[model samples]
Target: MSTGFIILALITIAGAIGAMNCGRLVHCALSLVASFAGLAGIYLQLNVWFVGVAQILVYVGAVAILIVVALLVTRNAESDRQNEGSKGWIAGGSVALLVFILLAGALSNTAVTGAATLAPDSSVETIGRRMMTLYVIPLEALALLLTAALLGAVVIALGGPKPGRASK
Candidate 1:
């Protein structure tokens, strides 16, 4: 409703689109960082300062950098291959349309049904406690997934030998 929210929404949408449609992996990662920052701005506008800070720190700082680094380490730097696989555009457009329709429906049907709200004393400590106690398993799974991705990238970048010449 506020100007800040409107600006942040625009930034988020533009950055997300740029990230999705970028030809270069590094550019996509940078656009992701922009999108994360925009989301953080929205969190701040909603008065969740801790969430905003954590979003910026975790997403823009660590995850985005890690994505760029992984792409650089595993992919050929000189290659300019765009994502032009068969049915790529159709799949992407279908997903986008589905997301738009779902979001529109959800927003139209949303109601303010909450009775209890967070107290003024609520801090990052409460969030941390809840995450550690109730969300620990999912957090651990995400960490494990990231670890596996890192290991896979390392293997792809450093473990392979060059293919031999084919015999005629």
Candidate 2:
């Protein structure tokens, strides 16, 4: 409804489309960063500064960089050859239509609901405390996931066999 909301929505949609349709893997990753930044902007418009900051810091900063690094390490700068396989256009168009229908339905049925809201400072501090205390398990799991991704990247970058003639 607001100007900020309209701008953010355009940014989100454009960035998402760019990310999905970009030919270069690095360009796609950069588009993802733009999408995350737009999401953060939306959060800011909603008065959730903590969430906005966290989105920029975690997703735009760390996740985007990780994706770029992974793409580089895997040598996927160009589109994959496998993507040229048969009927890809049909499959991709079907999936896109389904997603568009779902989003349209959701938007049509949405209603604005109001509830008691916390002060941003208290909300952020509470979240931090809860994450470190009650939600420590999930945090640890996230760390483990990052560790696994790093290891996988390392393996991909280093584990390939040397090129040579095969024994007959």
**Of the candidates shown, which would achieve the greatest lDDT relative to the real structure?**
1
| TM-score of each candidate structure, all chains considered together | 0.68, 0.67
| Local accuracy of candidate 2 as per-residue lDDT tens digits, 56-90 | 99999988988887787788434442355448868
In model 2, residue pairs whose N, Cα or C atoms come closer than 3 Å (at least 3 residues apart or on different chains), thus clashing, are: none
Model 2 misplaced regions, further than 4 Å: 76-86, 106-122, 129-168
Model 1 Cα lDDT, one tens digit per residue, 107-163: 889995866566455477987897799999999999999999999988996766656
Q: In the order shown, what is each candidate's alpha-carbon RMSD? A: 5.4, 5.1
- The stretch of ten residues in a row with the least summed lDDT in candidate 2 is 77-86
**Index of the highest-TM-score prediction:** 1
Model 1 misplacement above 4 A? 83-86, 113-120, 125-168
**Deviation (Å) of 70 in candidate 1:** 0.8
What's the CA error at residue 68 for candidate 2, in Å? Answer: 1.0
Clashing pairs in 1: none
